[model samples]
Target chain A: MLPSSTSDKVFRSTLFVLGGSYVLLVVLLLVADLAYSSWGQLAELLGKPEIVHAIWLTLGTCTAAAVLSMLVAVPLGFVLARYRFRLKWLVDALVEIPVVLPPLVVGLSLLILFHLPVNGVKLEDWLRSNLGWSVTYAVPAVVLAQFAVAGAFAVRTMRVTFDQIHPRAELVALTLGCSQAQAFWRVALPQAWRGMIAAFTIAWARSLGEFGPILVFAGATRMRTEVLSTTVFLELSVGNLESAVAVSLLMVAVALVVLLVLRGLGVERRA
Target chain B: MIELKNISIVSGSFALRDVSLSLQHGEYVALMGRTGQGKTTILEAIAGLRMVTSGDILMDGRNVTRLAPAERGVGYVPQDLALFPTMTVRENVGFALKVRGVAKAERDARVHDVAEWLGISRLLDRRVTMLSGGEAQRTALGRALSFKPKVLLLDEPFSALDDETRQEMHALMVSVRTHTGVTVLHVTHNRAEATALADRVIQLEAGAIQ
Candidate 1:
């Protein structure tokens, strides 16, 4: 052999190129699919009522679920971050289970358990009767399915956020005569806003990508529970590959916009 | 005056054994110890930030061991000098006054006065993140004093400052003690800080006072 150092350098360079090429290949495939199929057709399909309605419903359900998730996740994150309770790690692990669990498994599980009648009352029926909520195969069900998955994302991120904030600020506020609530609001909330916003964006994106749960629990009826991802599935099932690609392209666009906006916000906040 | 009667706080891996300390009005007592030698634990116990396992805390001779931090009237500036970095200097200074439901005009005037007294009047509009370490410490000090607390507990207020700033902070502490007549219990591992500002310096080793 040649010089050992030169061989080591060649080996590292080869590995680096291999890894980078793999990543580039995946990106190229995605671009090719979008470009060859639906990227040019988007302007024509932009006026389609069914597509428009699905987009609106997707945005609406995702927005509602994201908001509700934040409301629950923020407080839950605080409890998880600030307090040491029995089985706290178990609770944290349970929160993260959604990220690893197959979305289809989550959907099927919810359907099997909640869709069935419990003591002469179907869970969906009971919700409608008692809580005035129309559950499965409706907007509420779609949101619930999204919340179950996206809420976990918010909780995980928000928990880290709260952990990063120094409790001393809250204590200082308390010493100054602020009630604990006031301290949390005036001190902790402002400091944690960036992380909260980031968590919210991630949660919203998760809700947007939600398909299996929404499909199984909410039923992707045309123009009804048909969110963007669900629309792609429906289109694909019907051999409408162009429409499916169109919906996928739309989703990619939405995701790009969300990430860009969040990045800008993150930079602005830091400045 | 503030007093700790046999305060014993035991956090996992650290315990503050039967410790007692007192400060009369206008007196500044410095608690000097090495890091992790229970300096902070003692201050925290006095501030009600941590629960005393089997002892009592008294503020102005009132038993406040079980009272929440807000009700204790014991202003505490922790070691990190935890200022709300998102808030402006004026907002941070007025925090306690606002919490007490002081009127807007009164809170503003008090904030202005404390900001001026601490020589941070020019920094009132600056964010805590933008302030120097010395400036941030002063902002924390000003915030604590704004409440006109019955006592002040500073956990190494000048530890983060450079020599010049530390000297100025020592002067500021003296002025604060003179003006408010508030009893103070300051915890610092620095001998210089203790010797500079303390009316009495209490040394500790392990959990007990040496």
Candidate 2:
């Protein structure tokens, strides 16, 4: 029999290679399938007005949702990272619920939330009548849904980022005649640049891929609430496999670009 | 003068009970203790970084225990220096002046003067990440001094340096105290460091001063 050490090494190497190859295989297959099926229709799909509009809508809403998420996430993240308080566990769980819940459930929950009465007022109907704003089956609902889910991811990323920073830096800044706000803005915020970038990108990418919530809350109306993910779903529902495949390819491309940009930024930061 | 009157602070498993200490104005006092003996805790209490469980802190005859760290007119140099990595040495040194909305010319002049005084004028343009341990210490000192604080708190500022560098830092600290006339509370575990630098050395065991 072989030595135990040699057997252990062989076993570990085999497991590692298998695990690595499995991940590589899944990604390769996805790309290959999209490219093979959508090759002929890709040009036509790109030129279509509805497709082009959906792409722009996806980009615009994702950007808006990402920015909105960050505006809230920064303070929430800082508090969660630095402070200890009663019900902190509950707050943390609430923040992460969206991330854990199925995308369909999140979408359904948002749809249900809009219909609920708030202090004797039906929020969805009241907004529609008073502010001329409709949420259910509307464009704004797309962004709202995206924000609900993507914001959670942003908060998680930022919290980890803030936690990594040395709290002494802020204390030192405060002792240097800086108010708490000044200390946070000048020291903590600057130190958290990498985390902010990562959070924004994660949120943006998540919003870009968000489909289930948008479909239920914001109906996939062509050129209105249509995004890349919804475009694929809508096309496939109508037996338009080529169009669905093309949209899938577009999404893959966008995700690839985002990953590449994130890597590039990481490299730049290190340099 | 800086005074901690019967301060009691409890943080998780570590506690400092009735830790009272005082430093005369322009006097450099060193707090020496074993590791985890609450030397830093007392310094933090004076700097308003820690909330005291009881008692008060007075700075220049003013009860500043309830004041915010920014309002306390205290400058702190943590053990790691905690220099703003993204900022150049000039920006790091001039952070306080900038925060107070001082004019560009005045801030620049003040930053340069402190940098020159700390012998880090040549390092002004360099990013803090590029600095060596000694340079980072001086940058932290210059930043703290730029605020013209009523009291300066140094937490083992020279503990990380070599003997030669530590000696240089001790000399620098002496000159700084003489020029600025700022009351200082320095925390360290090194008896040699405390003896070399402080006007009075307070020994701490457990939590209270021995």
Candidate 3:
């Protein structure tokens, strides 16, 4: 048998190198494959007006969804992190259901909800007539589907962030002549700025990669609801593999650039 | 004057039971106890951070049992200081006044005055995370004092300081009390600290004052 110290060292070193290399290798391989496939087609894809429009649509809708998610997540996360009430576990589970549910299921459920009759009136028809907007197979559906899943991630991140903060900060603010709202806005929310950035970034990135829900709920209509992910899927279905790879590479480049910018701006999650 | 009449609090497995104490106006009282003996709990109870299950808290003969912490007009410096790390020292010190919608000129003036008094005038532009232990404590004290609270609750305000710094903080506390005449309730486990800072030292055992 090996000496206890030597065996322990070996075990740790082996696991560390193996685990570290595994993650790095996967990412490197994916990027390399995309680069190789799209080497000549990237410029062509970029030149296409439809592809350019899809990229812009993805950026816009993802940003809107991420911001909307944060607006919902902040208060919900604060309540979950700070307060105690009846069936709090139930509420927590409900918030998390979207995270665990299949993306396709989320799309189907939302589609079903919009179709359901409310008070003897069809919900979709009522919304279209009253608000002059359509949800199914529309641009709004893309945002809604992205929000359904991405908002769950935002909530989870925010909850963890608020949980890390000492509640005494808010309490101290209160004792220092701040009303509840004042204490939250001044003390608690300021403390959560890094977390807010993290949540927004995670939700935005998740929204960018979202495919199943967007495709199922909002059909891939060119220059309308088609995002980069949908663009990739459409190109692949048309047997244009190089075009698909080009769009995928664009997504990877954007994600890397945005993350670098955020990090450069000193928005980081503290332990 | 502040009074806790038969105050009791139960938080999870730890509890403070039937705690009663009274401090005269402008009095500096130190609460001493072993760890887990509810010294901090008592201070929190008085600061309105914890709800007493069955007791009345009175301040200046007014029952403030159900009043929120802000309305209670108390200044609290918790054990860890709880400085808003994201804000500059000036902002942290001026937060109470800012939340009250005090004008920019007045708020800046008051923050400057408090920072000067705390010997933290030079550190006002620095972030709270950038300060040393003593500086953070001074900034926290300045923040608590910004609103000119009638009562001040300090939980081991000097526990993390070195010997020389702790001595300086003790002197600062004495000066603050003399100048402002704010009632002080300090919680500390160190007997010498309690003896050095308090007008009357109260010993706590199993949540009761002895």
lDDT of 3 by residue, B99-198 (tens): 8889999999999999988999999999899999999999999999998999999999899889999999999999999879999999888889889889
lDDT (10s digit) by residue, model 3, range A118-181 = 8878878898999998989988999999999999999999999999999888988888888888
Superposition error at A114 for model 2 (Å): 0.8
Better TM-score candidate (2, 3): 2
Best by TM-score: 2
Over A1-271, each residue of candidate 1 has an lDDT whose tens digit, in order, gives 4566878988988999999999999799778777767545787667888889898998899899999999989999988988889999899899989889999888888888777877888887788789898777888889989999999999989999999987877877777777877877888888898998899998999999999999899999878888899889988999988878877888888878877888799879878
Q: Evaluate residue A137 in candidate 3 and report its C-alpha lDDT on the 0 to 100 scale.
A: 94
Query: Clashes in each model (backbone N, CA, C under 3 Å)?
Result: 1, 0, 0
Better candidate number, 1 or 2, judged by DockQ: 2
RMSD of each: 3.6, 3.2, 3.2
Q: How high is the TM-score of chain B in model 1?
A: 0.96
Give the Å shift of residue A25 in candidate 1.
Answer: 4.3
Tens digit per residue, CA lDDT, model 2, A227-261: 89999999989999877877888887877887788
Order of all candidates by lDDT, from best down to worst?
3, 2, 1
